[model samples]
Every structure is written in C-alpha cells, then in structure tokens.
Target: MFEVNRVTARSSSLDAAHWQRRLDVLAENHGVAGAVLGILHGDDMMSAAFGVTNMRTGAPVQTDTVFQIGSITKVYSATAALRLVADGVLDLDKPISTWLPTLRLADDAAHRVTLRHLLTHTSGIAGDVFTDTGRGDDCLERYVDGLASVPQLLPPGTGFSYCNSGFSLVGRVIEQVTGKVWDRAMHDLLFAPLGLDTTMTLPEEALLHSAAMGHEHQADGTLQPAARWGLPRSNGPAGGIVCTARDVLAFSRFHLNDGRVPDGNTLLPRALVRDMRSTQIELPFYDGDNNALGLAWFRQTWDGQSLIGHDGYTVGQNAFLRLLPSHQLAVVLLANGGPAPDLYRALYSEIFAELAGVAMPSPLHPPQGSSGFDTGHHVGTYLGYNHEHEVLDDDGVPSLRWAATGSLVDVMPTTEGEYEAIAAGGDLLLYREPGQRRWRPATFVQLPDGRSGLYIGLRAYIRAS
Candidate 1:
C-alpha cells in the first residue's frame, strides 16, 4: 500500500515525496533517460519529473518540459470533428466523400466511409500509411489525394482497426470545414481555448519550449538521440502533437468536467462529450471485463470501475494517459525511451491502487493446466502493416514467427495459439488475449464485402491468398 506523507505545494491528497522516491527507483532500474508524470484529482494537480531531458546534454527535465504526445493527437482531432458536428458544419453520419470527394480508396465499399467510422477507427483503410507528403500547407490535401494507391483492409464500418491515416483524413475534414490548417484550427479550437500553453504541432512551435528530445536505447546499453525529430507535418493529426505532461492532465480534466474549458465556457456540448467517452464498438476477444472502443478513447474495466485512456508512441518516446471518471482522477506519464514500459507499468499500478482503489490488472499468464488442443486449425500466415506473422508447429508445439521491417520474433507458445515473446534481456512480453486486460492478440475477422483479414492491434491486415 502507498502511504501519504506530508502534503506538498502541488497536491493535497498525495505525498510527493513518496512518488518521487518510487519514480527514482523505477527510472534507475529501467535506464530511463527522462520522464514526466502528472496526476489530477478534482481541482488539485501534482507532477514530478525524473532523469535527464537529453542524454548528451544532461539537461534536467522540468515539470513543464514538453515531449511529443503522438497519437493522443487523435483525441484532439476527434474533439475538433465533434465540434464541427455541434456547429452544423459537419454531420457525423454523413459520408466523408460528401466533404472531400477527391479522396479515393482502392475499394468502393471503403469509399463510402462515414465520419463516424473514421472517428471510431472502423474505416478499414490501411491505417499505417505514413508517407511524407511534405511540409507545405497543402500536405494533408496531397495525403488524401495519394490514397488512391492505399488498399482497403476491410469494407468500411465492418471492424475496428487502429488507423493513423483515418485520423489524418479527419484532420483534412477539419481543414475543409474550418478554412484553417489542421494545426492552426487545433490551436484556435483546443489549445488556446483550453489554456494549454505548450501544446503545439509544428517543430518551430515546439522550439519555443524546453522540449525533450527522444532517446533510443541501443543493444550495447548505450543511449543515442533519435535520427529524426518527428514524422512529417502531414502526420500531425494522426500522431504529432507535442505538449507537456501537465497540459495533458489539463486536457484530461476538460473531458472529466463535461467539455467545459477553464474559463467556464463550453467548448463542446455535454452530451457529445459523454458520447465520445461511451463505448462506440466492442473489441473482439478482449480479456478485460468490458473492453471497447469509445470514439478515440480506449475503454477498460478494472475492479468494477471504468477506466478510459489513450497511449501514444513517436520515435523513441512513449506517453500514457488514464482517467477514472467515477473518482474524478487522471494520470499522465511521458518518457523518452529506455525501459519506459516497465517504469510506466510499475508507477501507474502503485498510483491507481493508492488513489483510486483500482488495482492494476495482473499480467496475463497461460491458463492453468492446459490441455493439448489441435494446432492444425490455427496454423497459417497472418499479416499486419508492413509485417507478416507465420505460425509453425515446432516439434508438436505451436509457435509464432513474426517479421516486420527488418525485425523478427520467434517464440514458442505458452498456451494455445499465443506465444510468450521473450526479449534478449529475458523479459516476458505476453502477447495473448487481453494481456493486462487491456490489449488482445490478433484474430480473424470477416468483412461484409466477403473479404477476410487478421484484426490485431486494432487494424486489419488482409491475409495474403
């Protein structure tokens, strides 16, 4: 159990000393270069920073230091789209082609996708198309124009897939309706109105802050700066927003407070806010009590309580946000590579347990006393974005062989059809159904158009015939 010590200047309910000590221990153990953690309980907010902002410069991370928030940008984009819905500028149920007719997909069914499908990630379009459409203002325009070459993974509205390109299209919709560039509209609609000082989309805007550079951990245990600062500007709406942990907590508070901004102005209607956080689609084969997709938010049930949150990754940085509406609490974690996953798991578990009375769900292990099951039915090749999965029978035991962009992982099964991905350092990455009751392994999904594909990581990979 975590104990509260003397109150700090920033929080009334938490012991800053206690969290600082734990963070220190976790960062040291994980070789983390830099991190920021922030928490909000009602009107009270507390935050702590650990490690260095840059490995070479050794600059200490300040509480307000900014890091790339990545796909959390999707939530901002989704909020912007819903605002358009409220203003009668756009209809959620209307076909996206009604607004951007120039956009094209390889499948006719996919071409009929609606705004709702894009927001919920059911558009079925190949989601990982991160081509650099240049830094010009017309970048997203070119991005959508180039979609003629992108294939449809499934017919639109059939299944959920994590679609980065879909969010980029949403950004284009914002541009079409608002007559402002996506990032400019984002600032005017979200950042400026929400009083978020550091949240921004461009490298030039980010240069104004004491920004943290991403650090990649090498095989020899050395850390180096990332070769690229970020993806192209056109990827902004998908996964390109940069902000501090404190600002992320503020954004979480806005959602918790029924869409009201800091100045008591309603940025969006209360009902739309509720709908955004409500379950929009059911995730297949998820292990949690009730895991589903809620607009841009991912929903999970823990200890009979509902948790809504989103996580983002960009280059060498990872960001996590978790909100407990019932408790009126939210937590944000930002890290620049080097064992970030391990630290986040440990820190969030302790914080949520102590503050919200919700236990961090246990890591998934193979079912107790497994009976031998037929492996023949599950053997085949599964595909993902720029990757392939090959299931093989290794001496009567099932195994998963994955190859992706010059990387490979071959692991024997710990149970039927699921394998324990062991890292070189002997870490167990259990990639089975609902590992941690949050994410599930890939499974076969059939489209309404009579096509089949593997649905994993919230995106479909059309199986090669």
Candidate 2:
C-alpha cells in the first residue's frame, strides 16, 4: 500500500540506481513493506534502499536503517569464541563444560560437547526454543543454566541440526572467559574493531537509529506490522542483532579480508577466518540453501563457484548474507516481510550471474506426473524446540500438522496449521503453501544419531521416541 523513496550509493560494477528500481518493483510485487541491499564487490561497496521503514508510519527506508539481522548473530558469537581461541583463553576442541561447569542438559552426552560442536551446530542440543531470562547481566548465564530442560536432538559431534541454544551457550562461555556479557563483548571485539557503528544488540540501542520493524502478511492479502520487535534478550546472542545492510556487508568484508581491521590490526587470525569458511560438516540438501557449514558460516555452490555466508529470520523480518570468497564479492539483503526467500532467489540469482559470473541454482519443485509416495517411514510425531510435528494420513496422502508449544505460539502461523504433502521420492516431500500454487520442499531425513527426523522451515525435528 506504500510505495516511496529509494536511496543508493554507486559503485563501478554494481548499478545501485538500476538495482534500486528493481528492488522497488520486486518489493511491491512481493508485498514487502521494504528492503535494503548492500554489496561489497572487490572492496567497491554500494547499497540501495527501497520502500518504507514501517508500513504503519509511511517512513521511507534508508541505507542505514537498522533491521533485525536474526540468526546471523550466531556467526558473531562464533567469531567471539574464535577470538578467545586465538588468545588461548578457550580451546575449540575442548569440552565447553570445562569453562561453564554449571552447564546442564537433559542429554547424557551433553558434558562432552566441545566449542567446535557448538560452532558447527553438531552439539545435538535441542535449540529451537528460547527463554526470556530477566533483563540483567546474568541473562545468558541463567539461560544456559536452564538448558537442562532441553533434550538432545542427536549426539555431540555427530551430525548437523541447526541449533540456536548452542550459540547462546557459546555466548555464556564468552561471558565466563571475558567476565563480560555477550553484547558488550561483541561490541568491543567485532563491532568496534570492524567499524560497524550501527550494529547493536539491545532494543534500547536500536531505538537510537531508524529501526525497521517487520510486517506480516495476512491471510486476507494485507500487510501488518509485527506485534513484537524481536526475540527475548536471552536469545539475543543467537538471533537478535540489529543493523543496517551496510553493517552486514562490512562484517562480510572483514571475514573476506581475512579478519583485517581498518587500522591494520587483525581482529581474528587469518587461519581462523579461513576455517570459518572451511567445511566442518555437510548439511542435508535444503534446496537452494548451503549444504555445508563451518563455524556458523554456510558454504554453498553456484555453478561450482563456492560461497560462504549465512541467512537469518525472526518474527517478520528476514536477512541474507552471501560471500563469494573466491570472487571477492559479498551481498546482503534485509527485508521486513513477504516470501523473502523467493525474493532472494529472484534478485541474487541475477546479481551473482552479472557480478560474479556464477549462476544461482534453480529452486526445487514438485515433479510432474508424481505418483503416490510411501508414508510409512515418515509417519509419527517429531519433537521440535517450540512445537511438535504430526505426520498424518490425509485421505491416503501424508500431511504435516504443526502445533506450537512452549513460547512459540506468538510467532506461529496459527495455533495449528496443516499441509497435505506428496513425497517426490525417498524423503523429499512437496506441498503447496496456503494460497500459493508453488510447491515447497520438506524432507524426512536421518539424523547422525540414526534417528528419523523432519527437516522443515530450516529447523530440525527429531522423531519423538
């Protein structure tokens, strides 16, 4: 309903003006309130902003307007741990319990979880759920201490299951080492040294800037600003940083530059930065997603051109960062709402093709002439951090019923939602989202611990035993 100003900074290879036009058109077409894009092409940085900061206020978005960067904060936490590793204050391969002796989880093998396991999401900690500890300096400590209620998804050092609690625990470890909370440590170590003036963690800090709140799409085809700003402060270490696209791009540049600070000091060792992009483990194919992860960085290929980056989402906002390390090119996209993953595909596919000569792979869709799929292996209840997934029989076809539990009810599509799906083949299920013709992919995959798991919406749900 609101279409307005677009601002841009130019570069040699990136046509900010042209891309601003494209962003404006695409944003409106996709019904997003606004989007900001920043690019770092071989040190030639450029940024463009399109649409409004808030649909309710009608204020236009600017290149510097801060939006929640979501789980990308995980990378920042990993960097913090690596910095400690660089200083001999922490050991990457050593058990985290060495640092946080009070650490507890429901799983028996939790005591063996190393910093490396947490960094790579192999800690097997059930992490989707987050708690709101009091807004105090000890919030992370309380959160980590309460992790005893969380069950294990797999086994430590086993396989990949995207874990938010793992990163938050990493924040707790950072606190123990530096005697500073996660936010202060990140600001001192990464933000200050990297010159990310707009990057911040707390809502109070974001209030000083032109912060963009998210807008949710309604079932009646309307956009409404999200009811909440972000997740609780306790979860801040995992998914709660707020920053401009430029800051996101700048952070990417630091890693791409091998951790060099602007004033010649190295914020992180070059080997550690490279290790951040190296393959720690391979993730199951998530269709158009990076299938490999390294210390919170996701590695994926486009036309055999490897890229290292991460994407994140919260409430109603989505943020994406992709760095073509070999090409000295990185891009960041921050959007308030809508089918943002689709927008990422549409815009980034072209950007990489033009700027990096890499072709983005097409997203997967349901194959035509598809036949009935066996639902035997995938039926049953799978437990997640925030909800339980029920694989049901919808008139002979497999269907998923989502039921939000614990603290996720506020963010779920509804208290309960169901999607009828047809398996494309072994484990790949295709289902059309409500009111959309496009079929989306979900999978019933095996966990490293050999348990059947459901992979959907970038979160893992292990079969409830």
Of the candidates shown, which would achieve the greatest TM-score relative to the real structure? Answer: 2
lDDT of 2: 0.82
Q: Report backbone clashes per prediction.
A: 2, 0
Clashing pairs in 2: none
C-alpha local distance difference test of each model:
0.76, 0.82
Q: Write the per-residue lDDT of candidate 1 for residues 1-465, one digit (tens) a residue.
A: 112122233655667767777877787777788888888888888887787777777777777789999888899899988988999999988888888876677776434899999989888887877777889999999988877777777678887778888999999989998999998999888889899988999989888888888887554657787767877787899899999888998899999998999889899999999999999998764533237988898898877788888888887788988899999999999988776766878898899899888998774444434334334554577666555666566664555666553111111111123444221111111254212223234455565566555555555666567
Clash count for candidate 1 is 2
Q: What TM-score would you give candidate 1 relative to the actual structure?
A: 0.88
lDDT of 2 at 159: 73
Scored by lDDT, the top model is: 2
